[model samples]
Target: METTEADGSLREAAGKVQQAAGDLLGDAGVQVSGKARELRAKAQQLYADLASVARESTLERPLTALAIAAGAGFILGLLRAASRQNRD
Candidate 1:
């Protein structure tokens, strides 16, 4: 009886080792972390590019700023209308 119990424990331990190894091989967390790091690098590069472009392009007029503000407001209003339509 004791020998059988010991063998069962060994089998359980072996199963645990295999499970751990399998988990290590196909880990979603590791994949997601790698993807997140890649995305962060891309975003940083894109932000730097945007900053350089901003430094180069001059929208140096009061009318240009007003037009930009009006366009943004119109886009936002359109988004709100779309959402309202979706709910209905």
Candidate 2:
């Protein structure tokens, strides 16, 4: 998790540098690529944060976590079944 956070930070920093270079060179492609990279890094960081929270929650109340997981799985199964029915 720490490694992931560090990597995300590095990626964000690199992206900012890329964006700045693009701006200086007047290149639309580089700018777009850099923006995408920055967004991805942010998303990664967000996921890591969420995962850490979830981990702590699970440790605090494991049965609740299990129930939630089961409910989510059941809902996903139902959704998949409905999609298949529609296709058929």
Candidate 3:
């Protein structure tokens, strides 16, 4: 998670640099790509934060966490089965 945060920060900074350079050069594609990269970094950071929170919550309330996990697994299985049916 620490490594993920570091990588996300680096990517976000790089994206800002790329975005600025693209804007200065009037390259729309580069600007869009840079924006996408920045968003990806932000999403990664958000995911890590959520995971950390979830981890703490699980530690504090193991039973509730287990129930939630089971529910999520069930939902995912349903979705997968539906997806496979559609494919077939």
Candidate 4:
């Protein structure tokens, strides 16, 4: 997790530099790629952090986590059904 955090931050910072350079050179492709890289790094960091938090929370309160998961699943099912009806 520590390594992931450090790597993600570094990748994101590198992407910023790349994006700025691309802007100076007027290269749209480079800018777009750099932005994508930055977003990927940000997502990875978010996932890692969220996974840690969820693990700890589940360990501390298993029943609460289970209930939340069930509720989320139910809501998703309802949303999917509504979307299908709209399509029909």
User: Cα miss at 75, model 2 (Å)?
Assistant: 3.2
The deviation in Å at residue 87 for candidate 1 is 30
- 1-87 per-residue lDDT for model 2 (tens digits): 588888899999889889888999999999999999998999888888888899999999999999999999999999999999999
Angstrom error at residue 11, model 4: 1.1
Instruction: Give the lDDT of residue 41 in candidate 4.
Output: 90
Model 1, range 1-88, lDDT digits (tens) per residue?
Answer: 2443445445545545555555678976655555554455455556666665654553556577578789999999999999999999
Question: Candidates' lDDT values, in order?
Answer: 0.61, 0.92, 0.92, 0.91
Better of 3 and 4 by TM-score: 3
Q: Estimate the TM-score for candidate 3.
A: 0.76
Among these predictions, the greatest TM-score belongs to 2
C-alpha RMSD by candidate, in order: 19.2, 2.2, 3.5, 3.4
Report the C-alpha lDDT of model 4 over 1-88, residue by residue, as the tens digit.
5788888899999889888889999999989988988998999899889888998999999999999999999999999999999999
Ranking by TM-score: 2, 3, 4, 1
Cα-lDDT of candidate 1: 0.61
Deviation in angstroms for 31 in model 2? 1.1
What candidate 1 gets wrong by more than 4 Å, as runs, is: 1-24, 59-88
TM-score of each: 0.38, 0.82, 0.76, 0.67
Identify the runs in model 2 with alpha carbons over 4 angstroms from their true place.
77-88
In model 4, residue pairs whose N, Cα or C atoms come closer than 3 Å (at least 3 residues apart or on different chains), thus clashing, are: none
